[model samples]
Target: MTSLTLVVFSLLAGLLLWQFYRLTVACRRANRVDWGRGWMNLLDGLNRLFCYRYHRLNVLGMRLPKQGPAIVVANHVSGLDPMLLLASARRPLRFIIAREEYQRYGLNWLFRAIGCIPVDREKKPEQALREALRCLRNGEVVALFPHGKIHLDSDPPRRIKAGAIRLSQITGAPIVPHHISGVRGEGGVISGVLLRSHARIKSTSPIYPEEWGREQLQALVQAVLDNKSEDLESIAN
Candidate 1:
């Protein structure tokens, strides 16, 4: 099938899966279900079909905390990063998406099926942070893009927003640095010579308790971006 056909099929399949999850499978009834993990199994088939070839590197260190819950704070490189993580992470992950994106009827059900949490960028920031803490306290892994918005650059990433750091302090959940390396583009045709641009991702061996500070988060992300830049530069030369 053509790319358009594949995209249409994927959307239809996603919608049907979302409905199945809500009516017979979406997380519901506290203690009745793992709530955080209920929909993952249902989406396995769709993920295989739709998600492009993605490579995960250095995942050996990624792990579930033995005691409670934690946040997976990562750099945002592409729109497909969420699906890549969902297919790879053994634990169910809840994502923090903007409230406007969540309210749109077309996406709400599909996102809900995957257990994403919505934040109102225009409203109370503290309220969004609190909701994040609540999810962590309940033993759920939460994913947040610290960049807040996309920054296309070869330099170190833009300053990460404060919410991920503040939540680290509030919940004491270690901020595991998730780095998505090697994704880039703007005007190039989606097909063509971009073969090398396939997504390459890795989660740092979880940044430690004392290391969850904002400066620490910035340093870790910068280092990862630098390493990625060097690799690309070497390939060019």
Candidate 2:
């Protein structure tokens, strides 16, 4: 081969190897708190890299405690939101997803591999909630998109589901409010990449559920959502 061609091939090979090394380090860091789900960190690393490249994901307030169970509640926009959160989190996160989405053809294995708990929205969502609570009690993080499903019609102000708050009330797990924006698309990977938007994750201080009623929990959520709405609006304009 020509000298120029040989040089180009060597450069490409070295770059690929460097990326693989970085991915390995990232996986190890994320797996520190993973509850026997380190394998999923490989996928999360890849997804996070994709978001960093295409979506410009900026995560804030992610300094979670080293130990203990906590509930992560976020506004769901696209399917990618979960992956984005997983990518940004320091611990392995168990997502409570809709059963239909969980059982999507050819993707069920992927969901199961990540230890996602599926909820039958039509019938027994309570079962899923119970499972999530159990996970929290066992000192694992449970992530819930309290909107119940992806809401792409508009920005914030959408009603927050009470399941997350209810879980916290039962388990005394701190609820971490996560508000995201700029996760554009119809929950499709290709569309999200093509959109090339700047996504942001705004996480607030953990709200302990100790001695707090459902009404109080709901009020805190509303206040957080209102603030997110204003932040999103300012970004748009």
Candidate 3:
């Protein structure tokens, strides 16, 4: 009886190890950004699972350049917005987040590790802009919610901040606009992730800063985010 029990235990352990190995491979394959750490890679995989499985995120017409710097601007609805963008992206993104959100308890370390640039809106906002410029100069992608905060469609109309357009003009990086919709928790941070919803990310063509005036660019970005642009397309699942 003892011998039989030992054999069963060994078999179970082997099976568990095999499954773990498979999971590791899958994570590695799905991870586009080389986080350079095993734990981060695992986290990235888990994020992908959360967005694709739990939230059922559908990415449509999203195209990023294979290399060089670019600015990704998305509409802010829920905290899940960033995760949805990250999961759909094929490159690492340095997010320009609010200072308070960047300093969130227990998440500050992760935010720093992911290269988030924190802006103190009331004080020294240019500090974050400088950092964003540095990242772009280094050929890194910088992402931001031009809306500045979590603004819902049902709320009063608000103009998007001009920082993203300014960044594009200065860095000469094309701005890629994406609109997020169908989030279950529209305003809550944790609730946005915890709740299940059929989320969709619709991306439009890249807007070149050199081709349009600042005002025009801002209006174009707003149209894309509002889903009022006629160029939006969806990819087949």
Candidate 4:
């Protein structure tokens, strides 16, 4: 190549790199992500891009404490649900996921890095609970889907599990509920991530365990997840 051509090519590459760096910084700032790891921060940027740009995810009234122990509960719809939550959260969330999903081929390492606690439903599930308790004790955020599995909004009525309520009662961490909708690939994991969606995440105010009984709290969470609550207002940051 000629010297002038080489110089022009180098300048164009430099400009592209500079633009990419700016974009990454903007993404991290928008997502409130500072994972203390370059690779993780990069992954967070990619996640923001996928959720915000690719899926067109519209997050409404979702805000968590700047620094504290909290439990985030959402309806399990598609595999993309976690991504939506993570993108909306200001703090790092340690997810309580199913063991089988956590152990998925090629994704286990990523899951572990993100502090995912795996529970075997048929086996000793309390093991995961203990781990989550420990995280909350350390003032970390733990997120889980109370419905246990992917139960769509149109499916038959199913009761949510009591783990989130119990955790809130034990740790004094408020339970933040969110409802997800508009996922194109509603059931499959890979498909959920790959397909384009006009996703919407509706977040409600945190439910403090001191305000209600166990059964009542469970019912409230279910109502919020089912989008049946009348006073589901978004909490202000």
lDDT of 4 by residue, 1-237 (tens): 999999999999999999999988876665557888877987887787789888999855366877889999999888899999988887888999889989999999999999899999899999999999999999999999999888999999999988999899999999999999999999877788889999999887788889877877787788889987563332111
Compose the digit string of candidate 3's lDDT tens values, residues 44-110. 8878877888899984435788899999999899989999998988788899999998999999999
The TM-score leader among the candidates is: 3
**Candidate 3 C-alpha error for residue 224, in Å:** 0.9
lDDT of 2 at 28: 60
Comparing 1 and 4 by lDDT, which wins? Answer: 4
**Poorest stretch of ten by lDDT in candidate 4:** 228-237
Q: What lDDT would each prediction earn against the true structure?
A: 0.60, 0.74, 0.86, 0.87
- The superposed Cα distance between candidate 3 and the true structure at residue 167, in angstroms, equals 0.7
Residue-pair clashes per prediction, in order, are 1, 0, 0, 0
The local lDDT score (0 to 100) that residue 232 gets in candidate 2 is 40
Q: List candidate 1 segments past 4 Å from native.
A: 1-40, 52-61, 155-157, 184-197, 211-214, 225-237
- Listed per candidate, the RMSD to the true structure in angstroms reads 9.8, 5.6, 4.6, 4.1
Model 2 weakest lDDT span, ten residues long: 228-237
Q: Write the per-residue lDDT of candidate 1 for residues 85-166, one digit (tens) a residue.
A: 6645656678898888778778798787866788877777666677788898897788887777654445454766767667
Itemize residue pairs with steric clashes in candidate 4.
Answer: none
Q: For residue 111, what is the lDDT in candidate 3?
A: 99
Worst 10 residues of 1 by lDDT: 26-35
Error of 3 at 19 (Å): 6.4
